[model samples]
Target: MVGARFFNFILFFAGLAVAFNVKTIPLNADHYVKVLVLFWLFSTMYHHLRVLHKTGNTTVDYGISYSLSFGIFAGPLGLFIFETIYRFTVYFNKKRTGTDDPEEFSDTFYNIGAFVLTYSAAYYLYNLLRPVFELFPFGYWILIFLLVCITSLLIDLLLIIVFLLTSDIKTVREAVDFIKSRSILDMGKTAFTNGLLLLFLREGEWGALFALFFLNYLVSRSFYSKSQSIKNKIERDKFEQMAYTDFLTGANNRAFMDKRMAELDETGEYIGIVVADIDNFKHINDTYNHSVGDQVIRHFAKTLKSYINGNDNLFRSGGEEFTLFLRNRNYRQCLDLVERIRRGIEESAVEAEYGPGTASISYTSSFGLYFYRIHHKVSMEKGYIQADQLLLTSKQHGRNRITALDGSNKQGNMPVSIPKQKLVP
Candidate 1:
């Protein structure tokens, strides 16, 4: 919309200003080169406008292609015409690809296509017009044409892949960010190689070739900061995830719960802490083997997750032990939740066989429950100790039961026990 039109206008005016500043000779050959330059500029501007329409921004890809067009035309007029056709031909009837909106991919494709066409056209025009003035020796002409083809092909291949990969992205800003952060080194290497070829093989052109190589070096150097920045971001994210996650159960770990407790304390919110342990866990591993015990632990973790509130967190604190942090919940309601979890584990059968019914196994869990009070100012370590004391009580009295601590200030509260419920095999 307004943004697209604004960018298009900007590109057009900027190209025009550049075009007007080009050196012009009154002679026929000079005039023709100038025309080609104008064409190159216009075509490039048009293509960029198409890019803006699709991706909402212009990028380094577009800028590089524009620079190549400048090299091809050697004058503003040729550049304008080539760019203008590129804009119209590539974008006029382009369909959107899954990777990119129609406009962006089209603009990239057209930029590449336009370079091929304009370079071909400009070279041909130069040859035809130069014959009249006996300018541009055959050796020089052949070298330019050969170099143009090689450079265009290389740039096209690289840019085409980038376009295909990134078209689906929302904006040119994101696309460029991706390139800057991830792919710049590869591009710089390619540019360096190409520049090296021009410097070493093309006699008498070492100065220009060296300039291009230096430009490539500078471009490569520019990306070091961006690449390091992205690397830091990725590393930071990975560290954060590792800090909070249990690799075995894919559940929150103790560190994550501790952080949540800090938040709860700051808010002075009510929370229910439920500690659960697999009943006679040692016996199960001894009876069926450790592998089966592992399966039971995984199954228990998955089942427990289903019964939790949206805001609640489930943690695998240790072997056969888990903790749930339920926000804004009281002791009675937490007891009810614990009972339901117990019943669920008691009734559900886990197939010992990772496969069919023939190898199935069954397991059950006992829970220790405690609710946090707004008036309580205890640390997570102390809360966990209190819950562990209740768990020992459950194990000592009988397995497969729920034991809760009353909402009391007295530090050593006895376990509030439930009846032993037998689980069906």
Candidate 2:
């Protein structure tokens, strides 16, 4: 919100400054409008350049070339020329990308194009009226004004309908339907045409002032598109993050763990699988509030995450239990890793958002480590079972500690041989 407000302020101030500076440029309002329009084109180009430099997106270069070419040849046909090309490009790109319904392109292209056409027409209308005020008598101006509104509204409505109907509209057809359903397109056109009339009223000419409207719309439209795009991307990115993340613990969820494991397996990379569980979690839920119990679980998960290396994966499989996948590590190394994680959870504190604590309470966790030998001819399902068995052994012996296939305890760093038993056939 703060960012959006700041951007608005920046654009507003920048427009005023651009206007004040251009006022000195000694051209009729029409020519002055063109100058400022050029400014807008340059400003947009600069913005694209900044994006390209920051993100290393070669696509921005394409945009830069497009803008430059459009700016050079666009002239009085600026809105129509640019929009027609832009819509075509977006339509083609959507087709190439293989998206089922690229609805955003339709909404964006149509909405933006509608706005541009409206502004351009308004500019022309205002210019057309200038000769009227200079030549026409009293009641004639009123008639022209009313006639202009009606005519412009008709044209604006037709343009709006055309845009909504055409372009990459399949994805956004519903949105278009809804917009048209609510009569917003009609309302928007009326509002915009009226706004341009008011602009003419303010300055008594269509020249530089029309360009001001154009600048204002360009800035506003750019901001709106960027913000909406960012919001959508944020939603998609957040969902992607959440899809892989555990809801309760905010760790990687089971599905994500499986994905990582499969990748490691495919590459024949050695990984230690540690399955950790909170001690007496069920009792905690039964004794304290489930909410507090949830906090404890969350704390345990976070602590476990803190102990892992960058290459390691920590996932919550279900209630009170988590799975860890660490790459390029042996049984002993895995044991040490699990022990560190267990100790971290035992010692670390977690702030209770809805639980009892001065500030927060600490929780402990027990972990079971199993060496997953990629070299061994074992199925992934079998390896997971082996890891689970190690977890069961850890719980059976004691809680609040680490247990490995080597039988090494969390406190003692020494390795212990696994008791060979074919738990799963």
Candidate 3:
């Protein structure tokens, strides 16, 4: 941190020295026109400059491109005014959005210092290389512009490296990685375009210059649009998943079951609707506690869910109650599935703490399965009602058992339980 603050002071002093000289202001019509053009360009592109997000709270805005052009075209004094105003406006905008939380606004100081130093360096470089253009006097301007932009970019990267090395990062590797994370392609592209912009401005071709800027804006806007679209889609999917999920057991909730059932078609394919509840759940809650009862519910749901396949959906529709929807399954298939789930629940144990003592709570569940094909004349609501009634029969006959009914027959089947189940109400 000390190193970074020291570096900021040095950069600020260098920028101040360049600002005091004030040798690059406009003195003629053509020079004033050039400055006006740069101002126009900056105003148009300020809001759209590509901002690259970094790991920390730091971001690298491509505003430096404008600063480089502004400095070389308008000189040091103009560069100083432009950077100060732009960065202050950015800081206030952050304030409007409730995000103006920097350490005594050090980031603003650092940004102003770093950018001013970079732009000032570019301006001086142009001064040093002015002799080369005079020597060639035959179209060596483009080369000089390219050299200036590339050198400015290197200086920008170097300053950032110094800042990162002393910032809150833990290691040299992490500091270097911050520099590496910048887009090399973007760097090359910006430099190349700045070269073209310089040539156009130097040659005093206003029409071509504006056209090039328009093209750049169009490309940036296109990328931003596509990126926002993808981001919005991901957020929508996340919301939908959360809406349909039960928070306790990570199973589909009652809302999701209603949606899936609503979309089903009334056809010949058998649909299995199983409504199961933990046997003596209130007893468990009373014996241990609600938290322990919750564990028992989760254990039962997990055991039942393990037997469900991709074609089925299991839901925690209520406390200590779960529902399953099995598609394209016959009567025997549905019965066998219910048997496996019941046995799974019978074998599983829920671990919980009871009055400061740990205990393994063994429990069981009762299921009522209504296996049938829906008739257009009868709504599927009847299926759930029949299954619920069958659940009551299982609880009445005994717990730890399944009572199934095949409802597509001429004569409706009464309660049918697994013969091997022992009575344990």
Q: Give one digit per residue, the lDDT tens place, for model 1 in 1-425.
A: 34443433544555555544554422366544544444344443333332121222334333233334244434444445445555555445343323344345434444434444444444345446545444546544344444445554544444434344555455667546544443443434434453343334224354554455456445544554566688799999999989899877788888887887777666665667788889878987887778778888888999999999788889988888999887666666777778888998988987765433434666677777776664456765567777877777777777788778765435855567785553211
Cα TM-score per model: 0.51, 0.45, 0.77
**lDDT measured at residue 108 in model 1 versus the true structure, 0 to 100:** 45
Candidate 2 lDDT over residue span 317-400, tens digit each: 878888877776776677666766666666677666654443365556666676655644764555666778777876776667
| Number of clashing pairs per prediction, in order | 43, 4, 0
Better of 2 and 3 by TM-score: 3
Best by TM-score: 3
Q: After superposition, how far is residue 345 of candidate 1 from its true place, in Å?
A: 0.8
> Which candidate wins on lDDT?
3
Candidate 2 residue 224 C-alpha distance from true site, Å: 14
Give all candidate RMSDs, comma-separated.
Answer: 16.6, 16.6, 5.3
Better of 1 and 2 by lDDT: 1
TM-score ranking, best first: 3, 1, 2
Q: How much is the lDDT of residue 176 in candidate 2?
A: 49
Selected candidate, larger TM-score, 1 vs 2:
1
The parts of candidate 1 lying over 4 Å away from their true place are 1-64, 75-234, 352-358, 374-377, 408-414, 420-425
